[model samples]
Target chain A: MITTIIIYTLLAGCLIASWVMSREKTIKASKMALKVLVKTMPSLLAVLGLVGLTLGILSPQTISSLIGTEAGPLGTIIAAVLGAITLIPSLVAFPLAGSLLRAGASVMTISAFVTTLVMVGVVTAPMEIAYLGRRFTLLRNLLSFAAAFLIALLMGVIL
Target chain B: MKTIKRYLPIIIIGLAFIALAIWDPEKADASLTVSRDYLKEMILIIPPVFLLMGLLEVWIPKDKIRSWLGAGSGVKGALISVLLGTLPTGPLYIAFPMAASLLGKGAKVSNMILFLGAWAALKIPQLVVEMKFLGPEFTAVRFTLTLIVLVIIGQIMERAFTGRHEVLWEQPGESVGQKTKQMGTKR
Candidate 1:
């Protein structure tokens, strides 16, 4: 909600400022915006569909059931993979991780889930690649996937 | 057709929905609902973001952008990137275009990497939720560790992928809202 407001505010401010400075430039900017939007639309739609399917298939109940049964390095790996692939909002995901933890998920498992849930975005990769290029998108997500596991293991050691 | 190739993913997703519908109507319905909600959110946010990026490209001078976020902007630039990123902005998809624009405007790859990283993983609201559910200790540790890892990853990426060499920013005529040197020099 706040994010929506902030984005609108920023957009309005920038639009007004650009218009006041130069109407021609403002018009040109709007055209640029349109062009970029059109270019990105296909990938954006793909990402949205993928997100829907992944979240639908891996409902929270199913995830909890799947993640809670295991309790070792393999469990952590599963948790990381789940996190990497799924795009759960933090409001739901953090609490879900908490419950999973309380219900006997290892610290490493929950940590892997939380870290990868934020860092590695398999679902959003199409949109990311559209803007950031395939090489950059691939490298960032791949590195983030590795980083999530490392962070999870270190968290397991520390806490 | 070229257009068909471009829309391949969407087409594949459509087929998948059809398969899901046949295999499990309930799951298909749920998926459609989720996709609808997401499409609504995207519709609400994406246009304004693109417009804002457009305006930013037009109004913000390349020199000013370089001074603040360029390769030489150093630690201060990196700190600013994190600060800008951690704002209660929309999702990471929103950040991708903005980060790309910044890169085109001569922002350091390292800083943009941090910007995207922070946008994704370390927003304040997200951290609060993490602390609430994951415990203060767990949140703090992950936060600090993630920050350190982001810096390292940013540096590694900057070294491995020379920012200017990347083809992402090679669109002709306009470079982040400003005309290129050839046109400017000719003018």
Candidate 2:
């Protein structure tokens, strides 16, 4: 809701200002936007479907069951993999993590879930590759996956 | 045929959805519901995003962009990138095109990493929600650790990519990325 408002408000502001400045350029910008919209459509649709499938199969309930079902290193690894693969909206994910915490998920496991859940995105890689390309996506994600574990491990040790 | 190849992913997903609907209608319904909601998001957000990027391309001067986010911009650029990332409330995928645009416009690769990392992990609104669910202490510790690690990752990535030459920022397309990959192998 807030994102919608912020983005549209910015868009309206930019559009009006640009119109006042140069109608031709604003039209040109709109054309550019349309071209990009067309270009980005296929991958965007692909990602949407992929996200649905991933979340559908690995629903939050299923995820909680898989993760934190055990505790210790095994649990952490399970949580990490689930987190890396799944693309839960943060709104859904945080509440789920909190409940898992209450329901016997260890600090280590929950932190790992949250960290990798945010940092590493296996599902969205195709859309990312569409814009940023394959190698950059692979490198960034691999590095982030490693960083998430380190961050999770430290968080586990500390709090 | 090319169109079929291009739409193969969607075609495969359509099949999967159909299979799920036949096997378990409820799961298929849930999946579609998720996709529908995100479709709403895509419809609402992507237009403004495209318009904004176009305007940004037209309105912002190249030199100004360079000075603000270029190789020599240093800590200021990184800070700006993080700030840019945190202010927006959206999925991580939304950051990809914006990051690509900035990279094409002379932004440092390391800084784009920071922008993306912050957008993904350190979003302010996300943190607030995280604190409500997780504890403040947990959020704080993870925030600090993630930020620090992202900067380190950014530094390492920039060095790894930029080591070869000015291959990355000179061109602004995925083909260049493939070239970088090929170059990395030759080295």
Candidate 3:
């Protein structure tokens, strides 16, 4: 698939760049990369496990029906708002969105969910505040959330 | 105990999600499978993107980039930040960490807001996907409306908050250098 090819190509490019950027010996750079891999592994595994469990339980049809009905537009808005409030990881959000798409969910709904999944983060607030001051984090997320809702609404109206 | 108290809300939220997953184990399982596929896809796409980001971090001079992006007092900086964000090819997760780094360096609140807004509202890949699933007209309208909303929302944010915090422009290494220069002058 095109997506598969793109992913492989990006991975190859990343590896090459990592190789080229090493000022230290190749071995040291490789070791550092390995360290990063190790550090991220546990979290990655937990995410994988959660994702696997979620897929085993929820049917795409159910999610689609929920977001794609006469009441679907309202449902879509609420979902988008909720998605913004909840900080689901990108790894988890995409497949869920993809499944909803496959199950005949409206493009509007999926788009809204994906946008909010990334843009608004009620959960990451403290971390965001600590990193980028309180005013910046709060205002940016508020704006992002509003933008996401507008994007979804327009998509529904036009599409 | 102190650390737990600080993170209590996050902990509670996580528990609630887990509880939801448990309450309907079968539904959770299906969702998890889809989520796994998504994760794999993300893994495939993210590394190279991160590499390019790292390259940008190394190459782009923070202050130079910041001056143009700083305080959304004017339209030019806001528009530039939004455009810059629209062009990037990755998910929001990747953008956040990098944006945080930029904020540490001298990137203004408006620029950061623009980046986050545009990144979320207008991704090219997602647009193409939308076109395929919906149609061209729909995608165009959504894109236009989203852009307008982001700008308006950004302006509102700029007006509402005025407290200038020290963390807004805390670049690493520069302060140490400044301190050293001051000490030298004093001596």
- Which wins on lDDT, candidate 1 or candidate 3? 1
DockQ of each: 0.76, 0.62, 0.30
Model 1 residue runs over 4 Å out of place are: B163-187
Docking class of 3: acceptable
Of 1 and 3, which scores higher on TM-score? 1
- TM-score of the second chain of model 1 compared to its true counterpart: 0.88
lDDT of 2 at A7: 87
Q: Which predicted model would earn the best TM-score? A: 1
lDDT tens digits by residue: candidate 2, B87-111: 8888788788888777766677899
- Candidate 2's TM-score reads 0.91
lDDT leader = 1
Model 1 chain B is weakest, by summed lDDT over 10 consecutive residues, at B163-172
By descending lDDT, how would the candidates be arranged? 1, 2, 3
DockQ of prediction 2: 0.62
Q: Each prediction's Cα lDDT score?
A: 0.86, 0.84, 0.58
Q: iRMS of candidate 3, one decimal?
A: 6.7
Between candidates 2 and 3, the one scoring higher on lDDT is 2
TM-scores, all candidates, are: 0.94, 0.91, 0.62
Ranking by DockQ: 1, 2, 3
